[model samples]
Target: MSASSGTTAHAPSRAPWLWIAALALLVIMTRLWMSSAVSWDQNEQLVWSQRLRLGYGPQPPLYTWLQWAVNLVLGPTTLAVGLVKNSLIALTFVFMLLAARQVLPERTAWLATAGLAWLPGIGWQLLRDQTHTVMLTCAIACTWWLVLRHIRSPRPLGFVWIGLAVAWGVLSKYSFVLVAVALLAAALTVPAPRRALLSRGFWLAPLVTVVLVSPHAWWVLEHWDKASGSTLDKLHPADTPSRLHGLATGSGDLLAFLLLAVLPWLLMATYTLGKFWKAPAAPAASADSKHTSSLPWVEPLLRHYAIVVVGALALMVLAGASKFDGRWIQPLLLMAPLWALSRWPQAGNNARGARRYLTACLTILVLMCAIAMLAPLRDAQRGNGDRLNWQLDAIAASLRNAGFDGHGVILAEHHTTGGVLHMLFPQAKVVVCDADDPGFHLGCAWRKAERARAKGLPLLQVSTETPAPDAWWWAAWPIGSMPECQIHNLPYRWTDPAQAQMQLEFIVYPADTSAPVSAPVAARPTLHASAHSHLQ
Candidate 1:
């Protein structure tokens, strides 16, 4: 098909929005229907959402804050978490489509948006378990669209919006700083973006970002060690004999992760488009040069992205960092589809090719939805234990039978279990004994537990197994003797009664009516290595 004919055939329409909405709804419904038990990351959010705070563990507060707001209305059910997650995912697509349309033909723009479904991290991981990364993806997509729009037509108001988007990005995840800096560097390499950056209104962008990010910035300053500790641990070299060895390992890991995250879309696009890498035929004198130059932003965007990735790898090697997660590179490569299509616009000019590409993308998404829906049943049949297979309802029932009474405090060994318990018993205060920071006890749940104990309210301790004598909870609140523990082996949620069962142990410490009412301990005990290892 000719370029004009292809553009007309796949003209801009509301069809893309409908597809995005449908996908979002499907994910939200699938999650609600799958199981009530939360995944590891979702449990972490539930634990953090118990109370509002400026910072929560190593990550920023944007996601947890949003979860708190959703839970306020939805009452801490799976629907609240699913709604927060899938809504951001929907926005990610919306922003990506808007950005693509700024430079590519409308049909090609839709292709790029659909193409995101081919990326494993965005298509599967986000739908399955990711939390903070989802919010960061949405913020990054918005920032990219706003920046591209400003490049097409600079306005003071546009700069202000850019600032707001950048602020949102940083609040979503600290790694967004790298993306923001790399994007600014990339824009400077291009003439139009450079001129736009030089515009007088550009100052508003930074000003707005600083104002919006300052409150959380202060909280980070006060709790720098707690906020950055986990991230540093992940980046720390794993007992390498030499820095050179660490560098080699870290570089290889970073590259492998980047490729895995983008290769599916890249390879599929190349195969489907036939000549995805071939240079386009020369434009005729009658061709509008203005329309050709509309795609000027893609070159710098891809170039700076490469520079940033290389620079990050080099820095990680120097710091002896030997580990990387696929999600870490998600924001950097989120625009891979757009870059691929823009590099060879002619490849996308064929109407038949576009149809096949969209069909493939839709097929992959459908498969992803199917996998998500049936994963629990598959695990049950195989007798494989996973988050979905957890029998949280049975566990909660057993605890109630032991006299929990839906009041007072429940101390859980791990954050995951704590979050599930919190969801089951929303009226009671739930605390993860394993999640306490060594230097600063930021978890208000701990204090609430102490006050509840002093008030002679029921206090229950729950764990997957019996806690060791020296467990962290013992040190936090010293009990005179180990209470009578009950062990229950309940069958997995969907598994047959004959299959392997989930083991749960709990100790119900009835109300301490004998102790005199007094203020809880002024200082918390230092976190022990055993508890730390259990958390890891």
Candidate 2:
């Protein structure tokens, strides 16, 4: 019998509820461990918490608002945020399993959910709240809903759903534009969906998204030239680590990282693909006309999703041509766990291949979760200096004790430190504005790049190799790329020996008379979240 016939004709003896329950239980446990578990993120979350804007300058306010709400209700403790983040992650997996069930077997759906829960990205999101996970989950859910609608009707509502999903995804993170692009263009990949282009609902979605995102739109309107443009400049070949080299770095990590995220989903998705890709040679004698033994109409939907997955990857490669972060590809990562879970095991009722893979994946996850859970392990990880670049707390404390209020604006040689300090003091206006660059150096820092100039006067540039002196010398400040002498140095005393270990720490106290006063004025900018449909 054809796969299409399987859906409509007779209900199989397969035990679906049990499989779904197993998936749900695992997802719950996995999320509980992952959340309240992560202590850090690159810097985006810090910016939002510090500034507390209607929308963020670069990122949309959706994730920020969502997180901010959680923080408000639960208190802004990392543990609190982690809990909510973890819960949202679990929800995403739940929906992913639902999506998997529509096409794959019970066994395959379980496998996909397992793959997704164990995906490293999902783990990271669980450990800490990532806007991408929240937003992308919505986008995928929207996709699932839209496809279901399309299956039932060629109505414009399907397109409207696509538009709204894209808009909301964009609201969560700027990167979601790629998904929107892919979704809008999905019709071209599959012949059946082309009819959606003509639907009134399809056109209406963009309009609704725009209306919803107008507040943020105005923010971008005012500051894109000032802030967003600067960020884009950093992606140029010259500003960042070598483009190819950077991509390769992320890709290597991605290869292993994404395997966990998407591989399972891929397996699950394939179950559906396999079913319809090569179904019955002719209509089954026992099947109804609506339920054909021939290829089910559902084949196109699977193919459409496949095209979306592949198309999104192609776009990422193009985006990565400049620079990439593993997190950047997160929107599409949901598919892996789904596909991975859906593969039917070759063995008997014993469940071999899928079960074995699931077990192996879960075992690795347990080790990782263990490593993350142990208090000693976390403390060790934080100060280990193997992963983190420097200990900002120690450095900040030293400056504060040395008569600095922890309120002064920071000028750093590298933008990362500037970014760090910005997080350190949300109340202060930390600007790369010294060089007209607006106070940061690269990556997210340059989002306000147009404002920075090369003002060659250097900040306190601490070398990575040298053990920092107890007293920061006025001589440590450099006139050029390398400091002629160490100037304005300060010493730090740690209660624990663990804190004394040194790493690279550069504090640029820009030589400005009004540094203190100017910071507060600059910190006044509000959040800007844009959701526009005009894609060039």
Candidate 3:
């Protein structure tokens, strides 16, 4: 064999693991630097993490429980919460590394693994949003690796891991069921992996998964509306014309988003496969022998990815899903390189292509890290009042000044404020009245607040406002309806006029149990009545 061919045939002596280590460290450091405040999703996650229940809001309890554990160790600072998410993101790449090593040579494996980190969906959306989907993404990556391991070397432990991972992924998000379906399809159709279906260990997997997720499944059964409402809300059927229109728009948008999500990897994949299509056929292997030989494990893995991604779009088109979020497929993006190289096996041996791919990924990774580091500083300097710079400390102090001693129920008109208050004052009662949950009236813990109100414990009422606010003006009535209210319009101290032209107001109402709580006093401004009507 020639020198370059020889290099492709064997693993390199020098370790590429150190490079992965450095990238992992960079991921953590960027997260810590970006961890000044929680985003809308992070703050919302805090609401779910308030307890270790089997279910929270629309999603399962695992991610929140994971956050709860992280909070226990690191405390609930933004950095600690962010670290939990960033660590999961790191594990995703690690799992990808393991999966890639199963199908390709060491150098190609490293390239594929590192390349996943730069996929716009994985690198940008997953890292920035840090949603429950992050956990699902990690679980899927692990499942892929474990499934490949079992197929490559049929072990019972691998099946156990696949079960555990699928369970974890399902617990993280219901959308993960798509990935499970993909895996099942792989097992059913692929010849070598098809043998796993008959294995006793394979049969044991579903039982293990069921046992692992039974508590949350039970919770979903008990609280169907709360658990499934958000998901169902998006799946409404459309009329024929509407469905056709949505099908065209949604498919086009989904394709665009998918392309953007996969980015340069998709481009690289297309380029590599194009070369494969153009290359002259090798006449080495006999036609019958080549046709009969077992397909590479990567083939079925790619099928799983296609079934989840393309099959999902097909179903959505059939169901008339009006819109699609690219982040929905973020978990599957890791399989892009595998799918590409599987279609064109010889492409994995292209040393020049491998170097170019790694370089592009590194460039994107560094550029993103720099942007993450600088964006917040710029926002803070501009006083944008984005979550990273939200003045939670000031809000806490304002509550104290209003005679809230971290006791009784504290009421806020918005989940953002309520969630932040809950995190800041763990002992105090924070009630958010803005939940879409049918069971929740004002917000979660409404019943708890009602009992406290009956007992006449003070309910510290607070509401925030911006200069040119939209629908948020209506939030005040629910909190304002309390009896004997004193309103304080405190200036929002978080941002400069240059950063944001918004001032937050706090209205502190003392709950007097001696008097019955009635409707808002007629003496109050007509704006209150107008706001109440809007809510109705």
Superposing all C-alpha atoms, what RMSD in Å does each candidate have to the true structure?
Answer: 5.6, 11.4, 5.8
Candidate 1: Cα lDDT at 524: 27
Tens digits of per-residue lDDT for model 1 on 1-536?
22444233444689999999998888888888888778778888998998998888788898999999999999988788889988998899999999887767677888888899888768866447779888888998899899988877788999999999999999999989988988888888877788887797889999999998898999999999889988987877457777777778788888887788789998888667675666663333222223532455565566676687668666866777877777887666788887777665555577888889999988888888888888899999987766778777777788887778888888777777888888889998877767343421444435655676778888877776333233444443545444445567677867775766766766676776685433333222322211211110
Best by lDDT: 1
Which runs in model 1 stand beyond 4 Å of their true positions? 1-11, 281-293, 435-449, 465-470, 476-479, 511-536
Q: Which runs of model 2 end up more than 4 angstroms from their true locations? A: 1-47, 50-54, 105-107, 124-130, 153-163, 195-200, 225-234, 239-320, 337-361, 375-536
lDDT of 3 at 22: 78
* Worst-scoring 10-residue span by lDDT in model 1: 527-536
lDDT tens readout by residue for model 2, 1-536 = 24554444445444444543554355446544433222234234533554456555555777767666665665444444454555555566556655655545445555555565555566555333355456566556556645544534656666666566666777766666655565556555644455545555656767777877787878777777643764465443465466677577545644554555555445543442343223323322321222211223334444455567655555554576454455655556556443322233211123555456556556655555565445333544454432233444655554444334544444333333444555444444444322223222233233322122133222333322243332222222222222122222222221233453443334344434333311211110110111111111
Query: Which one wins by lDDT: 2 or 3?
Result: 3
Better of 2 and 3 by TM-score: 3
Could you tell me every candidate's TM-score relative to the true structure? 0.88, 0.59, 0.81
Candidate that beats the other on lDDT, 1 or 3, i.e. the better one: 1
Winning candidate number (TM-score) = 1
- Prediction 1 TM-score vs. true: 0.88
